[model samples]
Target: MPEPATEEGNRILSLWQGSWLAALIVGVLVWGLLIWAIVAYRRKEGDGMPEQTRYNVPLEILYTVAPLLMILALFYFTQRDQTILTKVDDSSSHSVNVVGWRWSWAFNYEEEGVYDVGTPGEPPVLWLPVDEKVTFELTSPDVIHSFWIPAFLMKMDVVPGRNNKFAVTPNTEGVFMGKCAELCGVDHSRMLFDVKVVTRAEFDAHIADLKERGQIGKLDSGRSEVAGVS
Candidate 1:
């Protein structure tokens, strides 16, 4: 599979792959030890109740402490990566407000005042500038949904009353697929969208195009107010 297109996504993917490699190494060692014990200790007809041994303090402690250390190491790496990914700075060059509805998505470019609305059949396209930090403020006017972009390897829940935000710098320029990862209602499966990461010039042109089409304005009524937290 293609690696993530964003820097944060790549960092997260690296952590995940590293964790998997560690698990594989541990699994192989443990399985080899188990199999060796099973074969080496197999009962022969003459070997009746071979030496009843109870406590090997060193071996017991080794097994217990080794796993605990491994778990702590993994936890440390995971937490570090999460902090790096979730820490949003005020240096983002662009901002997009995402609203998740019952069946589709709405994206409002806060700076340009351009908005894109998705429908059941026709999905919306989110335009972003490549290699630039973009902040996404996710909200849900109706039910709970999730804004997920697979290429970015990031997904955040769109709750009704909370203003969840995340930032990503798309390093690659291309059109990527996105969708609502959560099942909100009947049309949840069809809640799809496209993400276009282009150059700064192209991004500006896109906003101008939207302005020409009269898609430039604030979001619809009742969307600005945050609903009760659920």
Candidate 2:
């Protein structure tokens, strides 16, 4: 089956294409003008001195200003996107806490509590609800690390002794492979994590069942497996 689309991925691709289009047009026009000038001033092998003149002020200004204008416009567009992307939405959004460890990842949902993620001997997997914006407050238990989901265009540094936050709204529902983008230790490449974005119903069911079994949330820790917290 095919993977779902992501807003971040789509935006990044569009930004790339748009930025190149402007630059490519400018580049082709500049080269075409240069070619026309050279051809218009072509000198026969034995022809008299080719007409030559020092740089014209207007021509010089046009040549320099064209590229400068393009750059300024691109900068403005990029800055606008960065601001829009980082701005927090006022609507209700779920929050998840992800922690970086020596060679694994841990996820803590405020409503569902925490759990040992991944396989018993393998790295942990991150689970999320598709189409939901998640505020991940990241920190490291030991060394510094970086979290990255390439398909989502989300990456952030996980620093020890301090918390760093990044947001993501994953529209796709699939397992996205993530890794520590920063080199923290000898086994940096071994630090891997999996993101599982699922449906809202599926997530709610999991949370409910987990809460009942006391598999999540510390408040229910002392309760019996099949009973509510007393």
Candidate 3:
């Protein structure tokens, strides 16, 4: 699989892979101890009753405190990563308004006053500059949808009534695949797009191209806000 394209994505991936490794190590140790105890304490046919012992306070405390500490560690890391991923930096270099429709997407460059609308077969391309943070405010006109970029390892819901926003700084320069991870409608499977990360000059040129093609206008879906929280 392709590695994550953004710093935030890389951070998340590292955390995820690290957690999995920790879990595997713990699982192996615990299982190994279980098997050892089963074999070592096995009773022979002529063996008498094993020595009866009441509560081992130290062992009980170890099991309790050890699991508590592990859980606290996991919680801390998860919360930290989530905060880093969802942090919205208003000072981003570029801002795009993402609208998820029935089976397509609309990328509106709010600052540039240009928008790119996608169709079923012909998906739109979102352009961004490498090493620059881009802010995306996502919403939906009808039902719920998701904006998922596989290479970025980022996905957020596009709800009809609210705006969900996130920021990503592309560290790699290349084209990556993007799609709607949520099942919104009949044509949900066809909702796809491309993310092109390039140099600042190339990004500017692409915007100019969009402008030349007369794709320079604000998007108006005419749908009323539903007051639902994102």
* TM agreement with the true structure for every prediction: 0.91, 0.75, 0.89
lDDT of 1 at 102: 71
Per-model CA lDDT versus the true structure: 0.87, 0.71, 0.87
Q: Write the per-residue lDDT of candidate 1 for residues 1-230, one digit (tens) a residue.
A: 35899988878888889999999999999999999999998998888778879899999999999999999999999999889898888999989999888777888999998887877788889999999999999987788899999999999999998899999999999999999898898889988999999999999999999899987775632223223223
Can you list the residue pairs that collide in candidate 3? none
Segments in model 1 whose C-alpha atoms lie over 4 Å from true places: 220-230
Give, for candidate 3, the lowest lDDT window spanning 10 residues.
221-230
Model 2, which residues run further than 4 Å from truth? Answer: 1-4, 34-43, 48-52, 89-92, 117-121, 141-144, 208-230
Per-residue lDDT value at 125 in model 3: 92
Candidate 1 residue pairs in backbone clash: none
Model 2 worst lDDT window (10 residues): 218-227
- Model 1 earns a TM-score of 0.91
Off by over 4 Å in 3: 49-55, 220-230
* Best candidate, TM-score: 1
| RMSD, candidate 1, Å | 3.5
Clashes of 1: 0
